[model samples]
Structure formats: structure tokens, C-alpha cells
Target: MGREFSHIARRCERAVVTAYRELRDGGRGDLQAFGACTTLYRIHHPEASMTEARRLVAEWIDHHVVRGASSPTDGCDCA
Candidate 1:
């Protein structure tokens, strides 16, 4: 988990990705976990619209979990 999330500079991004991965591994379906992650993001950033939360969450999952890339992601400024 540390190795996977260490590259993320923002707390929100790291948190969303970690929650998504854990949810997926803990027998939750893909969409279910995704929804949970989106909700998690919105919880942290109420100013974000549902669409924004969904996009950021999806990007985080793809970058950290699916692609395993550490490239900086585009999203919230919270750290």
C-alpha cells in the first residue's frame, strides 16, 4: 500500500485510490467500490460536483491501480 500510494502528493487522491483498492479486494463489485470512492471524494470536497468526483476517482483508480503508473494526476489541490 505504501509503495502504491507514495507517489501521490495529495491526501484526497491517495485516500480515494486506497479506498477503491480495498473495497475491490474486499469482495465488493467494481461499480460498487467505484461509487463508494466517488462518495468518499465528495465527502472530502463538498464543492466538487458528482461528475467531478466520478472523473477524479476513475482517474486515480486507473493511474494507481490499473496502470501502476506514478505520473502526477490532475485533480484536487488538497494535500
Candidate 2:
């Protein structure tokens, strides 16, 4: 995961973290943000299928953003 994500800059890391937190919150708005990231990933990597992009993002979220089952405010720095 580190190797694949080493290229991400600080801004992107923050955005990914935010997306992971929002998804965990569970609501239509949060889902939209999650979908936006996936959608952007698809647009940027047009050759990649949506499912693959989604899987990659989910893996990234699980590995880096959300490792354990903590409270909604536990892992994220969002207030």
C-alpha cells in the first residue's frame, strides 16, 4: 500500500482520509462524496473499470484510512 500510495501528495491524502470518514458516517451526502472520489478516479484512469477503481479505493481506505472499527470520530481528524 505504501508503494502504491507513496505518490500521493499531502492534499490528496487529506482528501482520501476525509472521504473515508464521510463514507463511514453513512448518509446520502457522504455517499455522494465517496462516489465523487471513485468517479474522479475513474475519470482520471479511464482505462480502469469502475469496479476496479472502487476496489482499489476501498482497499486504500481500509488499509490507510480506516484500519480498525473505532468510533466515527476516532481515526479521523475531522471535526
Candidate 2 lDDT at 1 equals 19
Question: What's every prediction's RMSD, in angstroms?
Answer: 1.9, 9.9
User: Could you tell me the TM-score of candidate 1?
Assistant: 0.90
User: What shift in Å separates residue 69 of candidate 2 from its native position after superposition?
Assistant: 14
Q: Which ten residues in a row have the lowest lDDT in candidate 1?
A: 1-10
Off by over 4 Å in 2: 1-29, 68-79
* Residue-wise C-alpha lDDT for candidate 1, range 1-79, written one tens digit per residue: 3345677898889889889888888999999999999999999999999999998999888888888888898778787
My TM-score estimates for the predictions, one after another, are 0.90, 0.48
Best by TM-score: 1
lDDT of each: 0.87, 0.54
For residues 5-57, write the lDDT of model 2, one tens digit per residue. Answer: 44344444446655656566666464576677677556556777878767765
**Candidate 2 accuracy as lDDT:** 0.54
